[model samples]
Target chain A: MVEAHSKIISFASYIPENYVPIDDFAAPADMPSKLDLNRITGLEGHRRSKENEGTLELALQAATKCIERSKVDVADIDLVINCAVGSLCSELRSKLSPSLANLIAEKLGIKGAECFDVSNACSGMVTSLMIADSMIKTGQINYALIVAGEHITALVDEARTNNLWFKSKALASLTLGDGSGAYLIGKSELPNQLVFSEPFTLARFNKLCVGEASKNRPGPMMRTKAAQLQQGVMGNLGEFFIRSMKYMDLDWEAIDHVYSHPTSPRAVKKGAGIAENTVGKIKRLHNESQDIANTASTSHCMLLEKSVQLNQLKSGESVILVSFGSGVAMLAMHFYLPEGIEQWS
Target chain B: MVVVRAWKSSSEKTTNLLKTICNLTQNLLSENGISFDDIGVIIHAGVYRRNFRTEPAFATHIQGDLKLKCGPVTQESNHCFSFDVSDGSCSPYVALNVASHMLRIKPEKYCLITIGDERPNKQSNWPYQPITCVMLVALEGAGYQLTGTNFDSSAFDSSTYVEMIFDSAKSANVIGESSSAAQINSDNSKFSGDTNWLSGRHIHAFLSQFTEGTTNTHEIIDQSGKTVTATWV
Candidate 1:
């Protein structure tokens, strides 16, 4: 029960205060009412960005809060990874003149940091965190700052307003909200709280979910077969969950909690059914999608942060972070929250 | 230490983007007397690409192009998954870092690191275009051990630059395997510290010397007057 790998030192998240309800989606009159939409989608509204907001800004806000909360000087941070560089929800998503991580490190006064950006759709933050974790575990760097920002409104805007992208059936974009999440992982004698981590991609299903720079619009737009994508993801999740439990010698019954990335309320419920099969009876933590649609890569961290803030997570507790996203990439992490961690900054 | 096999491929605008990556993978495997069956995973990095209009991960397309399959008949149970690592000029190094870690963990696995550059057809800073290099690194107990891997973003002189890399190597106790090579990406003004950068062709020639075998530890300077030392035992 005391076994662990890397401990999560600090966690922080930022969600834009702007709210855009389903009513503002510009759906046709034939579409379902607000109540039905809520009932069907399990989502009533999501956070949106105000004018002049972008991925870099949101990423900075999240990183700043994380660094500030960690009580560690910016100079002490050895590495900074921007997990939302190319996949961020902004018109400049594709543009990489000034890297997001480099800029953030500069502003934070982290002059001695090794920085890079890792983009793998929604599993990005975790992917970057894994890189930092490996670096720390391998003795390359001690402290790594991992951040992801999704100002995905531009794509949602393109899908809603642009005639070229006006595919009424493509509703995945409608569920996306804007937010950023950051985590600080350091190597210490404090025991390994982050036990197991892996990012696996099934290229066969990569086409199911993706975000790209819209041809007609300047910003990036995403198209996902919400139902079909959810099916593929659940199937993969079921396989990974069963296999991981065996590999890590974890008992489905002993597992304290299961936190999965939620795209929609309906999707969460459907995924929960899969969860039940593996663990018999499972406790699921998925409020990101419910509160802020699909925050893409930041979903896992945001969910973790929320849980920490609510005091739902306790020290020495075992939890599984299940994230599935674009490219159909699946990232599963096994963690033991260290004792004495106060709250998410 | 395992034997590291490297293969490089470059093309002009005339070459198809996908063909470049696919052919390079096949050729590297054939030259090494191995097949996709022997490989663990493929990691593709196309930091400079014009054919990204479809989707982000061209690694998937590369897997498809190479016709790699994972099933009951494929020898390996899990089909290897590929992902891109984008870090501008540092793309190959980043991919190498990831591959190194993978190989370190799964010693029986051979990770293929692929990087391509297809610059847009325009008069630009980077005269290099349509370049792809594949490095096959594994933990076969016979390949070059990447004794030290370094990434420094802050400002530094050439000594500091060399120290960031070599000091760690010294600490690791690897004095000099044979000859050390530096890829002075003249385009990286922050790190390269070059006033006039070298063309891709020139850098290509400099790296080709490694394959031909080196006589001594040489410090090869690109047209940008930036130095990168290369070593071959």
Candidate 2:
């Protein structure tokens, strides 16, 4: 029987130094700026990578910080899972082999850790969390490091210069920022551990947001049915919460904080409204996308880190994390924080 | 004990990864008298994808294609979890290890693991033939039960491995097999296709020689020189 549990010991995020404002997005060559992207997406600005800062470098920074804060020796780490959707290097080259997890483990001097990559769009970090939790519970491994480094703003550049399909497809690209997040998970018998987690994919909406290599220039391109994607996710907002809450045998009142994917300010507000109607009023909801933009897989962790820095979270307080990805994948996790999480920051 | 309920394989030269995976999954479910709702989790383990596409996991596409409980999970809805686990050719064993733990913890009756890879695009270089395999695993079954598994990896800096590289002339990212990769290949078992699916083929061979009250042990080395050893009794 699986009797053990896993708790997040420490976490860290790395945002590049280059910050780009919303107004900097030029109108597509073929069309005028009819839509106020800042007003529509609720993003003031997002961070971009400086030269020589790619997914690998960003991930290394975040992972190193996470390991240092964890206070766990590097040799004791048993597994490394890289969940970066944009696995691009500083050279704008794609990395598909040897696994980024292997590279990160090599850089960290952690030998013999089982390494792999998980791809679940934006839900990747949480998905990897579930996997790590399972392994810990089943006594497979003692400690696991799950990391994501997204240098995806290259898609924004692709969206800006695109002459065709700017509004319908490339609009969501502008709401992106380059960032990375890493979490160190270890076995814990303490009550303040991951209680329950569930991840689902409403795959029917897979085509709503598609990313591929740019045809017009170098780098990547993304086309998103922003409005429709929001609709599909919102349509089931109530169900996602209810089911996850039920599995954990808890209700909205039991949760101390709610951290949602920071896709956009408007969307976060809209989702809160929908949740309020079905799942009762949330005690506290953290929305941090206005500054960092959508950091893809790292959004939830970034929010957690922010809340820790602000000293808004206390030890043993229950929290809920909500996330969605391009596969129309959704994840909900109910967990309790450990002692001194703020000091880890 | 976690056991293999059934299995399916494909080597069709089709670039449509989702379509191929959907067909195999449907057939596996129907032949086993299982409904799509009976599945609680789906894990896709593939390395090379068309166009080096990264978002929206291929496993989700399989679930969506088959319409496997494709709705928001309410109190009454049967939810299916889907994601991809990419580990070069060691994906199948890694996924199997993950499934074993999940079946012990969750109440799910079955888990599906699928693997295959195709040339990213025509402009990119591909050294192997396209191949895919899907395995249905369950906690209570009458097939090979996974008893134990182990993994060991050499130093990444010194290991000779196959990896993806950006091709400037082709203007695309393609699979780049290092010169030392061939040297490692010489020590591996020769299959018709590339080494990515060697673990899948290894397990398939183990199943072919299954015997009652007997134990089987095998090891496979991935392109990155990670060795996975599995014991079935």
Candidate 3:
């Protein structure tokens, strides 16, 4: 049996320098303005990449910063995985997962590290962490690098073109943002900070959300509201929480913090209800910055970074990161803070 | 189970082809029961340019057309073609795996669509091979089966059979290009002088090994609407 003695060696995140206030971008005129964005989403502002910058660049920046903070060399990396949700191309044939790997290899001068991409929407980072942990435990890799970057603004239909949810879920567009986050995981003698407890999937509620019209057959369309609500409400959050707790052999009251995918205040509230928010320990962010909304695979990673940066977690404290995406996939994992890492002053 | 409709490709240039493909794909999905929003995730694989140019334009095109709220598109690289050549097995499988991971969807609830086009480049001296522009759609519906197995041919002496086909394709290009040049010179008969005598001799030698009733013959329909037949002999 493989045991996980894995911990996040270091983490880094990058948001573009350009700031896009909610009012500057084209949105519903009647919708709340910048003042309301700060009040609602708890976001004073969100970062937007300057023109001509792409997802790979954002990833590179975050990865480099992560390597620097982790005090590890890129050449030491045994594997590199991109958990990002956006690409520079529109055609299925032109997607850039492997190419990004090649670029990272060339830049880091790592000769033989296995590189690839993974997706699971908002939960992508945690899912990637699990895979990296497994690989490390199985001896498939020693040092793993996971990066996620999303440019949701490029994909949003500001025209409210075809989606009815755009009217009802206009808040989604406002809450989304563009950014990137990276993590380095490896075997260590130190006690693990991010202890991956278990992974439970509820795929039966798959039709919750959709985007990027198919290029072969259809023109464009959005996901049905029925699937979305089912995934949000009647879906498997309760089971996920129960299974995770069972795997960790802990009760709901034991968790000290919760970092969700930041879908919306409503989704977060409903998910919290699954565990009955028993300790009132659930904390949320990005309720205002819609630019990053449904950033798919990158949301969880980004949220985790923010939570850490905000000093919301402390040494020995256990936190739960729950993620859900359009496939209605939900994963709950338990992580303990590493020893010796001081809280942000 | 969702039945696959027609698989078509446009004859347009490869520039910004993703947009055109997305438009065409959307039309196809609308015609069917599926819609863009119904898609849980979009996995773009095997993206490569002739030269190194990294821009999210291809993914951006799809996002613009389909209004994808969230989904990661794969980076561009020559390996993109590996997804297709691997048949409907490997790349799509990887895409499904990643999509399930990212979209948090059940593997059974989503559909995987792959589209690609290889445009001819005229600058090279080699004869132009017709580019294959194919679009494949596989859904997570029930009552479907794929029956096939892949094994390494290197373990058998029959490996030479596959090598010969590749050699033939290369030699055919040379012969066709030289013949065209000869015809332009008004001396078509001179084209035979440029034939690769060494390769011809090797081909003949390679054929002799199969003459002892050791090889099998197979027949399949070619893309040209012809019942082409081939024998290892």
Per-candidate TM vs. native? 0.82, 0.93, 0.56
Order of candidate numbers by DockQ, starting with the best: 2, 1, 3
Task: Arrange candidates by TM-score, descending.
Answer: 2, 1, 3
Put down candidate 1 lDDT per residue, B1-233, tens digits, no spaces.
23355555664543456687778778878886877865656666544444233243667667656766422111124655556665444544556666765555434357877766554222223334444666677755444444343555533221211100112322221111212134434333212322222122322343454433323232324221223332333
| Poorest lDDT segment (10 consecutive residues) of candidate 3 chain A | A89-98
DockQ of each: 0.15, 0.59, 0.04
TM-score of predicted chain B versus true chain B for each candidate: 0.61, 0.85, 0.40
Over all chains combined, what TM-score does candidate 3 have?
0.56
Model 2, C-alpha of B217: deviation from truth (Å): 2.2
Candidate 1, residues A40-123, lDDT tens digits: the string is: 778877888767667777888888888777777777888888877353424343434223566667766788676666766777
lDDT of 1 at A152: 77
Model 2, span A1-345: residue lDDT tens: 646778988888876767787777633333455667676777888888778888888898899988998899999999999998867876666666657788888888988788989889999998888888888877778999999889988887777675544355787888888899999989887753786556677888988887766553556678888889999999988888777677667778768999888789889999999888887899998987787899899888777776877788887788888888888888777777766776766
Among these predictions, the greatest DockQ belongs to: 2
DockQ of 3: 0.04
The lDDT for every candidate, in the order shown, is: 0.60, 0.77, 0.45
What TM value does model 2 have? Answer: 0.93
Write candidate 2's Cα lDDT for B79-138 as tens digits. 787888876666777788777766654568889888777666787656566566788999
Please state the CAPRI-style docking class of candidate 1: incorrect
Superposition error at A288 for model 2 (Å): 1.9
Q: What share of the reference contacts is kept in model 1?
A: 0.18
The per-residue C-alpha lDDT of model 1 at residue A91 equals: 33
